[model samples]
Target: MKIKQLGERALIQRIAGLLSGGSDIVVGAGDDDCAVLDTGGDDHLLVTTDMLHRKTDFPEQMTARQIGWMSVAVNLSDLASKGASPIGIVMAMGIPPDTEVEFIEEVVKGMDECASRYGTHIIGGDTDAHDELTIVGTALGKVKKGHLIRRSGARVGDLVCVTGHPGTAGAALFALDKKIPVSQDILKALFEPVPRIYEGMALAGTGSVTSMMDISDGLALSLHDMSMAGSVGFRIYESRLPVLPDVKRLLKKQELHEAAVFTGGDFELLFTVAPDKIEKARKACPLTVIGEAVEKGVFIERAGRVEELKARGYEHFRQQGQ
Candidate 1:
């Protein structure tokens, strides 16, 4: 009866069933961060919001500025996956009354810097007092009618590809927990992640991307999501996984591989394209082809064998043991 027993995904399904979508709504909840809405124009409007709590999201090593940047970056990443041009961002903060004004100013500075980097600005928001620190950001963006990418367009035989690599953020988290030494690059990967905005837009312009989504939930879960949305399956080769060479050397083989598949926090784009259009897609955007879509269930091929892919990535309620 409670959320803990059902898990985040199940709870979302229940909530989605109760919600009614209007004709103006292009894409609603249950897929990505933003809900696409059509306003009888050549372009569709995208609305998305993301919230981060201090207890769960903020790391001890992160400063107020880093937290602020992350709060905005996460939402922008969602818009990027839709190949949308950001309109603006509105941020709401729930800060403790005792918090220093300087700290809050630094947070705003961080948000402004990150927004400027993406060619967007923070328009307005509300502030409130709370027992703990909470930051919420709502972003608005727009995508041309036919250019908007979704998670459901992937077809069988489509080539699955990803922008950049994975495992750096995951490995950083591991090192932080274990008190292991890590390079500045690794810390940067975890503290300040770069969203694939230009890459997503380029891929969308090529008209070759089928299903597209940000791999914030890890590669294995992201593939599962694409598979379910497209009503197809996927078979990714382990040898084809993209990971930084430094990470591979620092972590054990199994550890790095597991992080590549199971770690969340990476904001890279994972998308698919038709086999015939793979060359065009690659020309438009640099990405590594890791696999292809199949007819049925999701799988991964490794060491000359194949196995069913499991969703072992982050789950909110499950992770909290709620």
Candidate 2:
């Protein structure tokens, strides 16, 4: 069968099925955000990588600096979900031979600035000639063995929480597509997403969070992912969702809901906390309790009615209209 027919997630699962891990591997392929390795230290090693293409990942309006920032941000988001502190980053750039040297310099500068902002640095990387501008970033992180969080530890009756506002990035994309005027803040949400590094570490330290992952693939799809990982269900209330004023103002009710649930690029953390320990989680980070874990089936409550939450979001190797 064609790869497009299999879709991204299925293709990943197929490839993961062929892989095997050594005893040192704590979390292996297709399981969590990062590969956790027990390196015989006080902390576990975290590793994650993400690739961005000029045509599909980067918007035309983004500057070279923003592109660089985004490339690193995406990988860091994965580290954040694991409640790990970043150690360093390595990026590989695939660029056209005709690209300007100054543009590349600015890109590296952006990468450096983003890394430094999160208490890390870009140690080294490689560059090669390619038709399209492609950047692949690999980030290394560390978390204490007892403090590491995964997507598979959530339990029934746990409170579902999310950090920061959702849909802002999606709304920014919508605004850009329609050529609607929006503030730079809204646009920045898409161009330069801030990984919740501090919040993740704090939540992990609190010992209240049960499971966690970044919402890079939209809220609904993320819920589905966590559900499958933990073997638990989620029932989130629509009214409890934290909607950005800009998003609400920009789109109608239906579009607003769609942007909030189904659109991606937010890069916020979606996690579950023990209901009784929620105060500790709240003190650790600014989060909104929008729902709770259930026995089975992911559903969203809207207007006092419940419906199945479809696993739909930004996915690679799939047609937009599909």
lDDT tens digits by residue: candidate 1, 1-322: 8777888778988888889889898888876657999998699999999888888887889988888888899999999898888999999999999999999999999899889999899999999999999999999999999999998888889999998888888889888988999998988877888877788788889999998988887888888877778899999998998888888987898788777888777888989999999998989877999999999888888898998988778777776312
Task: List TM-scores for all candidates, in order.
Answer: 0.97, 0.99
Clashes by residue pair, model 1: none
- Candidate 1 has what TM-score? 0.97
Clashes of 1: 0
The alpha-carbon lDDT assigned to residue 169 of candidate 1 equals 87
Which residue pairs does candidate 2 place in steric collision? none
Report the Cα lDDT for residue 235, model 1: 91
Q: Scored by CA lDDT, what does every candidate get?
A: 0.87, 0.93
The CA-based lDDT of model 2 is what? 0.93
lDDT of 2 by residue, 108-183 (tens): 9889989999999999999999999999999999999999999988999999999999989989988999998988
Q: Please report, as a residue range, the 10-residue window in candidate 1 with the lowest summed lDDT.
A: 313-322
